[model samples]
Target: MARKTKEEAQLTRQQIIDAARAVFHESGVSRSSLDAVARVAGVTRGAVYWHFKDKTELFHAVREEVSSPLLARSHAILDSGDYADPLDAVEAAIVDFFRILEDCPTLRQVLEILILRCEYVDDFVDVKAEVMQPAFEFNERVAAAYRRAAALGTLRPGLEPESAARDTLAFTTGLLHLLLGTRDANGIREQVPAMVSAHLALRRR
Candidate 1:
């Protein structure tokens, strides 16, 4: 075999990751094999192994590939500092998440693979931590927004930022689960504005 340049190696690695996404999306992770991914990517089994130690590592890589962009968008929204009503800013961020999911099919598929296709038995419990880091950051952003709302007297006087943050986080989690379960072709994209409105209405002064 001819030697591959570093650029060729990186391209091959990404091709394998793309193939893994398709394979994992089509067949659950436990059922999908690196050989199947290699075939899909038009690479040798040795090529797949060169880039990833095993299926588990490849799965994590696939997730990281999709997740980094999603988290970056979330971080950008949190860092934008554009909304006068911090609560409105927080709601806009959540709405933007749904818009992203609706707008990007590749991303939506990756999220679907993570949410509906994968199981977390045994060592796979660690797989969940990959999800928690952004969630924790998201929670902090919501908490900060709530604190800003409180300071501005937009929030009901007695409302606590911590409690609001926790409730909003839990609500967002439930919304995502239901959205996945329903799998409505265009689900939540339209509903988010009204939902956020009703949610914030409850806490408004």
Candidate 2:
């Protein structure tokens, strides 16, 4: 009986999260309200309070839906010393980010919400700040990888590691911007691997 009740509680929590994403995505977080999320979830306003403290917290929870898995992979690659080829690990990680979009519809919706729907301002400032930490971590990780690659003679001679890291991140971000802004998934997937390959080709001897 207790187990069943716990499962129901978890189910309700997820329902609230999903509803929050849709509401914030459609209405934009600045304009959205917890009452709207509760209505969308078909739950009492108290249920939302039961699951989340407020709208900002709900927004973070929604962002974590995608960011958490990516963060874990980034941390693992950054922390692990066993990789025989750091370049391949980084390339695979980038490819996986694109590949998941094609395969996961819910993730695609959540990403669309993040990249297209929400604007960062006012109450969203703290949420934006939380996201910056991961970006800094990723910058350090990629910079370290480029430095190691340069040391091993894998990167083109005389290339600056920090510049290369920043450029790579910029290029990746641009690709994501184009993909999301245009909503061009069909040709995008076919070109993604080639794009990554060409980017790496320029760096290698």
Winning model by TM-score: 1
Backbone clash count, each prediction separately: 0, 0
Candidate 2's residue-wise lDDT over 147-205, tens digit each? 88887888788889899888888888788778878855678768998998888777776
Task: Report lDDT per candidate.
Answer: 0.84, 0.80
lDDT of 1 at 50: 95
| Per-residue lDDT value at 110 in model 2 | 73
Instruction: Please provide TM-scores, in order, for all candidate models, with all chains considered together.
Output: 0.91, 0.89
lDDT tens per residue, model 1, 1-205? 3456877999999999999999999998878888999999999999999999988899989888878888788767766678778877777788888778777888878888888888876657888887667788888888888888999998888999989988988888787777767846364656777887788778788
